[model samples]
Target: MTTTIRSVETFRLRVPRDNGAPTERFRAAPRVRSIYPTADELLLVRIATDDHVGWGEALAPASPEAPGALIDEVFAPFLVGVDIAAGARPLTRRLQQTGRERGHLSGIQADAIAAVDIALWDLFGQVTALPVKTLLGGANVDAVPVYMSEVNGASAHAKAATAALLYERGMERFKVHLVGPPEIALAEYDVVRSEVGTSRLALDAHWVHGAGDARRLARGLDERGAWFLEAPLAPEDVDGHVRLAAYSGTSIAIGEAMRHRFEFAQWAGAGAMAIAQPDLGRTGITEAISIATIMGAHHIPLAPHHSMASGIAYAAALHVSAAVDDLLAVEWGPRIAERSDSFLDVAFLEPIGTSGAWIEGGVVAVPAGAGLGIHVDEEAVRRLAAG
Candidate 1:
């Protein structure tokens, strides 16, 4: 049984959640509305050998077809027939170098590389009979603590109801995604706080604020004992983040837009954020670990962000989250699992415990198997791709 890349495939899927219901917060704050799509879109990659198959996904919230095409036209040719004996990291470096001449180490090109890198790691794990965590230097925690991301509803009372329901389901921490004036955000926060009755709330400003506005919001969050304030300023404003973090009592969180270690190194060096949130679907397993190392060196805790990506991305995040020692909490979208798990044969990650007896903690155990620890429905993926 020779171990070599036998086939490489890509799927672009767009699954609408709640019939593509419009996000109310985005409507209220149109400045950042374009940052997120109305539906969940994904770019999934499959790499197979003689006997085993591996799955990977990239964080393609919009225009996923671009990266899907990149995988087929650019990355697939280079990956097919390659030997998997040396494992994923060496191959990942080589693949990154292939695009270095084209200056394709960031953005959509890096995203395509991310999918291939993750699939290769999955293949490597199965071939070596080890979990991805072990390949990344073993797990430091038994389970990764998670914070429920976004308190959603139509109105303030509805938002409170949503928060209460999640609280009953064992979600102890939450982040409010509000992008506008600080007063509007604080009023919503107060509504949610009344329902959850906990000081473990966080906020995502959607990168819409200037330093002055971010400082005002941070003051409100600090008074409420927020777990963190995420993306307070523009993604490129490292200096602004450093300034805001310097004075804000609330921990500042950043890093979902970044794809490589170099960007993370700059932010880490500048002390731009109190928490580092590298998304595995964007950074891939190799670079996400590298970014984590950079964050660790600066004494910043890793909190890994999650949004509309599929279950493969979620599993990858869990593996990397477990491996990092200075972990805070992985961001968990409350209703994201419904669409994220739609195409999977078996759920790699799911809400633990049953209704009425839900576990009273917000921790997720790392999947317990080789090659990302989940099964992908290839037929379903093919059908979706064909459509």
Candidate 2:
């Protein structure tokens, strides 16, 4: 049986945010927080190995069309001839080799490589009859612990209400997205507290400050028993983060925008962040695991930045977090009954042996099925693909 990859296929899904109309979700938010988020876009890649099928996705937060074009014109042409059995690590190197000649893979180029590398790993797991995590290393646990992501709304009450709703649905922890100055953040934290009542809440500042503001907010979060503070300062300011970390009582989290291990190494070496959040779709499985190893050396936990990704990308993130020794819970965006118009949901993680959704009671199980352990609908993908 020829398990070598035969063809490459791609998809681009443009799901408008409520048909590009204003809604209570936005009108009720603390402020017009998101700057015209017209839609949520995703790019998916599929690889075939005679007997098995595998899926992957690039984290296309904005325009998937660009990465989609690059995957078709650039990466797919390079990878279609490769062997899945040859291995994901080397195949990743083969992809990066192009960047070495042309330019470093960043932005959409990095995303394209990620989609290809992840699909290769998924195919490898299918051929070997082992889950992707098992291939990386044993899944230290059956279910990867997760924290329910944001519940944004116009008012503090709205945000708290949204969090309460997810908690009723079996989520135990939450992350409140914050923007603006320190006073604005502290007030919202109080709102989150009044509603959730200290049930494991974390604050994502979204790069809202300098050393002084971050220290003030971190001090407040620590007093309230908040889990961690993310991106208090700019992404590249490692020394600034190190300075902030010295005074802040809360753990500092970072690495969502970073492209490689070297950047993470710089931050980790400086003891900047207590937790590292590497995006699986951005790093590809190859560099992501390497980044994990780098973070591990500094005794920093990897929480994995995950959002705007379809189920395929989420599955990849879960598998990596499962394999790594240090995971401080995965980030999940349930969106409180938000639209499910994207075809990506058709490929949600379906546990082979588990009874309920992969997510059950504030935790998600590492899918036991071979490969990424999810079912992707080919017909749906083709319909969603851009020309």
Candidate 3:
């Protein structure tokens, strides 16, 4: 069945989570507040073929409406009548060309392009009857390791409670997002470590600290015997990262803001980060696989980042991690598990023994079956869109 790209339809699907309650930490960031009231804010992209339909979602901006606008106003027009077989490269090239004169690649445009790239890959997977991981070159290991990401909250207790629940669910490896002052953040980590033990803990500063602060915090985390310290300094401060990475005993993890393989090459060659954390949604499969190769040459491990985007992004990350020989683990957010499953058709084959959660052994088995090996619940997506 030869499939011709008919038209690309983009829309916003807002499904409510927690009965419109403000239970999640990052939900109130003003940009995502409306989504809190609505439950879910997904940017949906539909790729139609003569005999099949493919669906994809964007990571969406903090703003409830930006993702949809990005797709409809910018991406959809450029992609509507294109050939899907050309794959993501052509679409990405067009996006780069359109944004070339804009001087930066860090806003709605990147997000929109990412959405289209993901949808195209899903379409490609469906067309070929192969999982995306196999399409990217198959897996070194059947499953990728998973590290639980923290829930944003005001208090250490709240964060600790969330961590404890995940621990009980069988996740031995964990990373917490530190939002407050350095001391406060340290205390939060201490509490979590006390509960989950030091060996399983890692801290993500989210580029929140300066060089000096990052150096100090990295040292502190090392003293606690934590596995690694992630994105402690600002994204562009390569020198700062190099210096901190040099002085700190804990391994440094960075690279989610980096969009292409060259940026990752620079960081990996410079020995700036011990673990490279590229986002599949932001980098797409092409650049991500390239980045993984570059990291492999330097003996650095690739640990792809997965945020609150839809399952497509998560599946894309899984595929990349599965293909990389030097992959360590993939990051997973519990919030996504709690809220996104209903809208996705084939959920991430639960990790084995976590009771509806990705298995806790740190390794996630590559999904089997065709095309991302998952399906979208179109009805549920449409319901959210209607709301």
Candidate 4:
């Protein structure tokens, strides 16, 4: 039976916890910025078909409230009662068309559609009784490597301590976010590089520097054997990224800010990006796949972003990562995940434990079963939903 979308509901989940864990880690290193929120709220999109249910999440860091309203006000009205079993392609095209006409093709508009599109795909997978990885053909790797992302800290010593903890836990790949002068960032990088023992390292400057500084920072890290220099320039400056990527020969990772594949094509075609990090909460599964396919043609690896999302989106990313050929590693947010009010559980292959993301091994396995391959507690989601 072809399933029609019955309803679309967005639940805002916020849970209470110490939230100060990461902050305390940065207590001595005062210059480090906090990218992960304390007491973060996630907007979960739930789409129910005649019989099956599907789940999705919007990337609402800092607990932005606009995407949920956009879903209720705009996306739901258009998606409800639509037979999505044919695939979410047409509807997504229509939604983007509508957004273009209304001048909201990016930002919140894109985010709302992203969540809706993910739910639609989850519904499709459930109907077929196959994991999404299988639905997207088959996985290229059995388990994708995981990368721990966090504020590397204020001082070099502080940075080294954090790296030491993660390294002891078996995490070899890391993306460290550092703020302040390029020199300060380099200092922390040097200490971490020394402590981590020839491990893979990437730096995210959080758009704190420009092409010149990014060039300098890239050179410093390159000389020291860093994997990639990420987001040194602001996300909108594609040309700047292109120049840096070309000049430094260091693969630049971008795409968390990008909403669709067309944007990624612009970056990849320009040779601006070496790795693409589209957030599933922003591009969702449909466009994330499309973007990955575009990047794959360019031989760019996909390292899907996962800053502050809950477990639902993480599970979704695992399936997509497992399906792709050139996959680096999914960014893990132990800081955010600890208190993000993510509520989902399902029996999965323990090829890796802990939501298929084994922190100890720095590798995450694809969750098995149908749809998004997790059981969501909708009732708990509603209760946890913030006002």
Candidate 5:
């Protein structure tokens, strides 16, 4: 009995705005211009075998210039009519291997592969009647710690206020997204650190700075007491990161934009990153676990990244975080945390501690249920899918 990939449905979920107001934090006031009109464009793939249905979401940018189109037009066609249970790993390997020659690491192809990979895992879990963490080697904890990710809003003051609010809500770890010059980022970091008060303040430079600039900014941040500096240089700048990590007391965190476990292996082997932040959406559970294992071998902590695509991605991250031995707290976007309940009809999973620190006294837990252990609100997915 083979589990067949019956069909693939690709659709866009535009979180509608009321009266042109920001529908969510990603779209809220003093718009950053770069992150607005946020939409949850996903490719929902349904695989069936023996009365079992497995759902997967491929989250892509709303813009045509981006990679979502590749997932819809290119990847979906390859996945149709295949047996998911038996063929998923082979298909993923083939897709990745084929993509390597074409230099297709990021974009629609990656997103599409990720969607199918995740769906296959979900299907596998459902078929086995086991949660993903159990499949990965059982749960290590009950819930994973979460850090509040800052929105790229217009005003620094408003963003700082938002950070403070999250801190008040039991978030100990906070990260401010850096989109501009080092000085501008430094100032914003200062505001948030002052607001949150020197606990676990991290800055994600988003690969916007060069080595020299990163060094200068990192030195300044070290003085101000930042826990880590993330993606200060471009993803390809492994040497730059290694140098920055060596020079600054701030731990260098990378790997979100990077795909594949081997990429993380190289980074970890080279001591390029002190923290390995892999997005399960991009790497999938299999590859993410591989990355985490590699990072664990190097004694590096795995901190998965989360965003506002669906609960699937978040659940996937949680499962992975629970299984990894050297797991650090995962990144949780407050934007998603605030609106996840409204978007999806499920209990707010777990309270990421106040002030952005997820691991209280150095311990975190994973959510327990069946499959990913998250109850997906099919109604919400349907409503967003309808729109």
Candidate 6:
């Protein structure tokens, strides 16, 4: 009879990209050696209390089945029948502990925990009739400034044209995803910068460079006044990042691949990165806030990374971004935002009484309802899950 989590459900979705065929989605990412998923793929979790339901998602850009299976085989059993009032963070810590002996502290295990953690926070908010931001203390900003994540196009001129289009759409900040060789990246940077006209440009090297090459690219980005140079070196090269941070004029940004505060703490303590970017879909709200606190202690600003997330996780990111004091901006993917409402019955926000999240004047207002503020269409999600 006690109010508790009555059930937990997980879904793996692989929706094709609107712009291209799914087979083409696996092409090697530009400027980086790794193959990136171009489709909208993610793992979702739904946690229901006696009277309300809450939703969450994980950043499973590819092979969502990994986290999906983990949730079913390991995480879901512990969540079912749990009291909703225990709170998200405590419950999340317990879940982490439950999996600790099995060596599940990181990787896809973190992604599974991330989904459950977000669902717990969303469930907690609904049970309390409070927004997630209020539950995270209180918001420091009503609307968080956003930056368009990548300027897309096969050619530098084409990419600049895309940047110009975004500029016309009121986007004031943008990051370009560049491929190798300092000169090639710099040349593309020049074209995109020209079109955007000094509107706070950033660059992502996709962790392809060694320290020497990264330092060379960092100097070029610095000369052009880049807001930050992200993932310039390989992900494991913490020492390399530290050395680059010491030598480069541009700020070094990292953390999207990282899943917890402990990892971020190491980066912060070593002065390895100047900016920290935690994806809520990867860390969930509980740990994202923890990462933010750790970064804040080091006076490192947070700019959360977002990619291939549905509306639920997108709302979670915005709520966390609003609550943080050291927010620089939330990475906004227009294509993702455009397709986010496919599984939601309600729009992510109430602008003009419509039910979708949109960027206007370069910012996204925090969603206004309890929990994540969006109603998940379980039927739609299930339909997609069947495929």
**Which window of 10 residues has the lowest lDDT sum in candidate 3?**
28-37
Better model by TM-score: candidate 3 vs candidate 5: 3
lDDT of 6 by residue, 124-224 (tens): 88998899999999998877888887588888898899889878666778998887588888998898999987588999888888767888898888788
Model 3, residue 67: distance off in Å is 4.7
lDDT of 2 by residue, 82-162 (tens): 778867889887777787745445666788888888988998888898899889978888777788776788877899999
Residue lDDT tens for model 1, 1-387: 779999999888877667546653222337783555666778999999998888999998877888889889978898899999889998888878877866566988888888888898888889988889998889987577888776777776787788788788778888878876888888888888899876388888889888888999999989888888999999999999999999999999999999999998998898888899888888899999899888889999999988878778888999999998788888886455676556784344555665543364577778878868777778888887777
TM match of model 5 to true structure: 0.83
Clashes of each: 0, 6, 16, 0, 20, 3
Candidate 3 lDDT over residue span 163-213, tens digit each: 777676667888887745567778888987776753377888777787777
lDDT, each prediction: 0.83, 0.77, 0.73, 0.77, 0.68, 0.84
Model 4 spans > 4 angstroms off: 20-38, 151-154, 340-342, 346-361
Question: What would the TM-scores of all predictions be?
Answer: 0.94, 0.89, 0.87, 0.89, 0.83, 0.94
Off by over 4 Å in 1: 20-29, 33-35, 354-360
Q: Give per-model CA RMSD.
A: 2.5, 3.7, 3.6, 3.9, 4.2, 2.8
Write down the TM-score for model 1: 0.94
| Order of quality (TM-score) | 1, 6, 2, 4, 3, 5
Q: lDDT for model 2, on a 0 to 1 scale?
A: 0.77
lDDT of 5 by residue, 55-125 (tens): 55555535422444565566667766677665345766766765775655565566666766776777777
Worst 10 residues of 4 by lDDT: 24-33
Q: What is the lDDT of residue 73 in candidate 1?
A: 91
Candidate 4, clashing residue pairs?
none
User: What tens digits encode model 4's per-residue C-alpha lDDT throughout 248-354?
Assistant: 86678888889888899998999888989998888887788888889989999999998777777787788889988788888875654464434665333222556
Give, for candidate 5, the lowest lDDT window spanning 10 residues.
25-34
Of the two candidates 5 and 6, the one with more favorable TM-score, higher being better, is 6
For model 2 the TM-score comes to: 0.89
